[model samples]
Structure formats: C-alpha cells, structure tokens
Target: MMRIAIVGAGIVGLAAAHALLDKGHQVTLVDPGNNQQRPTDGNAGWIAHMDVMPLASPKAWRNLPRWMMDPLGPLTIRPAYLPALTPWLLRFVLASSPARIKSSIAALRAINAEALPSWKALLTTLSLNGHLREKGILSVWRDRNHFLRAEDIITRQKNFGIPLEVLQPEDLKQIEPALHSVEAAVLYPEGCHVSDPALLAADLLRLALERGAVLVSAKALAVEPANDAVHIRTDGAVKDVTADRVLISSGVWSRALAKQLGDNIPLDTERGYNATYAKGAFGLNRPVMFEGEGFVASNLDTGDRVGGAVEFAGTQAPPNHERTSAMITRLKRFLPHLDENQPAKRWMGFRPSIPDSLPVIGQADKDKRIVYAFGHGHYGLTQAAITSRLITEMMEGKPGSLDLTPFSAQRF
Candidate 1:
C-alpha cells in the first residue's frame, strides 16, 4: 500500500485522510495542532449547496467603495496589504468577468451537487450522522432594492437548475417569527448544516484514527520531490517524513508549499470572524443568512453562532475582534428580543481563497506525486466531502466524475 501524507488537519485534510484509508492506503495527517483559528471550527456550518456564485462579481465591485470607507463593513481590505495584493487583486477583477463567473458557477455546481450524498456517506461511515440537520436555510434581504437586485442572481441560479423558493415578508414571518425587518426571503430546501462543527470535526478525526490513520502533531514547513517519493519537513516533534505521495490541504498556508513545488498559486486568506451566544439564547430553527449584511446566524448544538465577514488581511496580522463585535451588533439589531445579557464567545479564522473562488485540486507538478486540495474559500465546509472523494479517485488512477480542469493548479 502506498503511504500518503496529508498536510493540514482541517475538514479537507481529515476527510482526505479518511477517504485514503478507506481505499486501503496508509495515511498520515500532519498539523500543528491546537488549531485555534481553524475555519472548520469557526465557520457558519451551513452546507450551502446553492451558494455557487463567486465573490468577485461586478455587484461586489460596486459595493467596494462603501466597504473601504467603513472599517467594520462586511468586507474590508487593510490599507497596508493593498500594495502587496495588487497583482492578486487584478486577477480577482479579471475573474469577475461574465464568462469566468459563468464557468466558475458551473464548476462549483458540479461539485456542490453531490454535497448531500457525499456528506451522508461520509457521516454514516464515521457514525456521526446525528450532527447534521437537513432542515434547509433561509436567506433574508432587508432592503427592497437589495431584494430586487438579488432576483437576477436567483433567476440565473434557477436557470442553472438550482431549486429556490422566493418568499414574501409574510412567508418569512411564517417560517421564522424572529425575523422582523426583512423585505423578502429565499429558501433552498436541499441545504443542510452541522449542528456542532467542532464536534463533527473531532468525530471525523476519531474515526480516521480508529481506521489506523496516524495523526502527527507538527507544522509542515516544506515539501520536495525525492525520486518516486515526496519528502516533507516539519517543525515539531516529527522533523521530517518521506511518503509515496503528499496531499497539501493546508488551507491559507498552502500557497507557500505549492510555490516550492513549482506551482505559484495566487492564494490569499479571507479573515473570517464569528460569535456564539449561549444555547437557547436565540430560538432560531435553522441557519439564516442576512443577505445584505453578509452574515449568517445559526443555532448550533453549542449555541447560536453568527459568522461571516471578509477581511483581505494576510494570515499573520493580529485579528481585529471588532469584526466579531460588529456581527453581534448587527444580529442584535436584526433580532431585538435576543438576550444581550448572555455570555457570547468570539473567534477569528482564515479561509483559503483563490481569485476565481474555485479550489485548486489536482496534481501539483509534472511528477504527479504531489497533489493539492485547498482554496475552497467560504464553501470549504460544503465541498469537503466531495473534494476528498475526487482526490481519492484521482489518487487511485481513475478519472473523477466532475471536471477538474477549472480546479487545476495550472489554471492560474
């Protein structure tokens, strides 16, 4: 059996490890451990299969000035990083072209279409199906103009075969009584979410361990080709390791390693912030997306987690907790009755993002021994299982069901 080493212990890496183990390969998962800023733990936990639109759309450009003026806005880019981000920013602008967006949407849909089935199979195998809730998600828009503007994207999604149910104010009230300021809502019945993302991740890791996959607590520093094998250097207890193959799924930290392997991927981290209120603090039944506000409020097993916000700061910058506080403020304004007295938990994490909002998932070099599966952007939680499945298929010398051309590292 080939020994495969995967870098990163987040959802994607763990899922890939489990898939590789199931294929009877020897798997070792490497990570720094104590993942205080893991997106898998801090994300909104929504399995948003219908969220196929790239973030670099023309509409987003129109809102850029407003975001720049408001430091606490939903999306912001630090001034200090702007100069260094010029090239990537230009590519991001180009990726917003109609043709690129259409191609990206189609590519996203191809993988996201299998979200439910893949999650079901993975969860059942891990015996953690109880963590998932398939009650669907609600997207609410407060402004009439915003609601009308969303219709165009909704129509496009419908044309792409996504099922959406547009709801009036009354329909929204019937579904979620806590919502008061919404002009309209849209329901995607196929959507699902994890009740406890942290617990689910732990369970996935537990299952991988039970299946004989080793977990190494070390930071992967670099990777190199060593004849038919791949050599990986680490920073902690296990200084180095050599394996038959390596999969780089290290989230925002993946770009550096990819560069070392002859592929310069333009990857940036989307600094995301979140806050969780005590359990029973908000009696919301399912995840609710505040469309214009760019946040999602969901009731998880632990509490009600409000997550969303994009900061184009590099990975090393100290997190500005004000972002989390801003989300809480917006949540309070949305639901006036939410008890402010309860203790709320706050967190910040980085999401690996590519200019086109598509993940890089294929062979990294000409040798094909080094593979990459990172940069899922905000949809990593939704795409993790299918990504693992595709990686497994590729590793087994079989073509994946979905087209990998859009996700290839060479695309950049």
Candidate 2:
C-alpha cells in the first residue's frame, strides 16, 4: 500500500481519492475550502457522454470577431488580459485545424465512452445513486439557419457512434412544453445529469471519508521530490506531508504547481457563470442547451439552473454579474411562462482549460511518483470518473484501458 496526497478537494480530487482508497492506498486530500471558488458546486451538472466535440473550431474562429464585439455574447476575452494571453490564444487558434479537431474528438470519445459506466459503478459503490437523473438532455435551436448549420455536427456525432434523435417543433413541445420559440431540437437519449451538484460532491466526500481517506482543509503551497517520496506543503496545521505518491488535481491552479515539477503546461481559466431560480419557478424534465445562445437550462433539485458562457478573464478578476443576468434574460425569453419575479442566485467559477480542450492526465516527473490531472474545462464533471480510474491504473503501473498519449501533460 502507498500513501498518496491529492491536492484539490473538488469532484476530480475526491474521485481520485476514492479510486486510490479502493486500491488499498492511504490518501490525504487538501483544498483551500473556499466553496465559492469551486466549479463543482455551480456547474450545469450534465453528464454529457455524447457531447465529444472540442470547443475550439473553425466555426468559432469565424465568429470570433462578432463574439468579441458583443460583450454579452457566449464567448468573450477580457481586453486587459489579451497581451499575456497571446500565446495560449495562438495555440487555441491552431488547435482549430480540422485534423486537430478530429483527433480531439476521437480522444475525447474514448474517455467519454467509459464515463457513464464508470460513474454508475462509482455511485453504486458509494451508494449515492439517488443523486443522478437519467432523463437525457435536449439541444434546442431557435433559428432555422442555426438549426441547419448543425447538420455537420450531427453527422460527425453519428459517425462517432453517438445516438441522436432529431425533434421537430411539435416534438420538442411535447417533450418540454414549457420551452418557447424553439425551432428544432436534438435528443441524446444516453445523457444524464446530477440533480444537485453540490450535494453530489458532498456525498462523494462523505464516501471518501468513510473509506479512511483524510480531508485537509488548507491551500496547497507547493510539491517537490523528497528522497523516494513526494513532499507536499500546505497551509493547514500539518503544514507538510510526505507521501509515496502525489496527485495534482487542483483544477485551474494546477499549472503553477506542475511548473514547479519542471513541466510548463499552457493552461488558462474559462470563467463560467450561472443563475439559479426557486425550485417551483419552472417545470422542466431535462437539461436543455440553447444552441445559438450558448447556455444551458436544467431543472435541478434546488430550481432551474441557467448556465453557460466562456469568458477569458483571469481567475482573479471580479465577476461581471451582468453575465448571469443576461443568461436569465435569455432563459426567460426561451420559457415565457417562467416567473421573472422569482428570486435568482448568481455564481461564477473558473474551469481549467487547455488549448486543445483536452485534460492533462499523466505523470509530471521522470520518477512517475507525481501525477497531473487537471485542465478538463467544461467537461470536468462528465470526465471525472474515467479520469480517476485512469489515474488509479497509472499509479498501479498497469496499462490503462484507453490511450493516455492524447491527454499527456507532455503534449504541450
């Protein structure tokens, strides 16, 4: 048995801890404990196994200027940060090539192919199955032109073996009567979502604790090699910890720590915001993604959550609450019957993003005692279980079921 220290206590870190414990390892998880800063608490919560397309695409590049001009659009890069962000931006643009997109889709599909089964197994083992809902998700388009443009994407998804069902206006109304002004929709029957993301995370943490894993509420400072073990420094009373292995899964903050281990990874934060309404504010059976608007509205346990946006603002910038308000405005336009007077809660969090829209999940150093597992971007929730399983396999020196080269930290 080995002693492992995992930096980060969000879903990814907690999931990794659970996997290590299942393998008979002693785990200590460290986090800053700032609930507001954690994306797991406020994400859209969709388990989108069928959505394997990378965000950086030729279409997105063509619309970049328009999106940049419209500050309230789905994607924006803060002008002040553009100078320092040039390198990452160039990489992002380069990743938009057709070949790169095809490669990314194949790699992402490999990971997503195992996502549902892995999540189901983990939930069953942890006895937290009640937190998930398998009603599937709907992607709706309001404009006929926009709907027509999605044919290529639908074709590609079909080629990749993703099950899809096209829905006309009447069909869409029958599936979600509350939705208004939808021109068309597509349903991915295999999709699922968490009813309450925060509660689900709490349940995972509880299960980890029950399995003899330790949770340390502190900020991780740095990690270094110490003799045959890995040394970790944190802000808690037990400031230093020595472990047989170390896993860096600290989300957006992972880049700096990986750099400390001699790997300079190009990672940035995709700032996302959300708005939640009262539970009874709207009636919806499943999560719906507004195609052109680039946001998602899902019925959660607490209420209906309207979330989606890709802002290039750095992690430290103050959130622009107007983004959440704009999403609510768009949601109201989509569902005219929604009560505008209902109190809404707003939140913003950072998603660790890479130029290729793929995660970095591999060894950080030559010794292989330290591992890197971050840069999951918007699909973090969907890919967390598969990532954990792969990490466990790597730590045990076993060949993982899927190829890890595509997601290797050395790829950068």
**How do the residues 1-412 of candidate 2 rate in per-residue lDDT, one tens digit apiece?**
9999999888898889988999999999988786696788999998888987888875566557766777988888889989878999899878888899989988988999899999999999888899889998999888778788778889988998889899888888888888888788999988899978888898888888988998888888989787878888888898988899899999989999999888888899989999889876768889988886868988898788889888888988999988877777888888888876778888999989899999999998655899989999988899999999999999889998899999998887
- TM-score top scorer: 2
TM-score of 2: 0.97
Where's the lowest-lDDT run of ten residues in candidate 1? 58-67
Task: Estimate, for each residue in 189-216, the C-alpha lDDT of model 1 and write its tens digit.
Answer: 8778998878888888888998998888
Per-candidate total of colliding backbone pairs: 0, 0
lDDT of each: 0.87, 0.87
lDDT value for model 1:
0.87
Where does model 2 exceed 4 Å of error?
Answer: none
Q: Where's the lowest-lDDT run of ten residues in candidate 2? A: 58-67
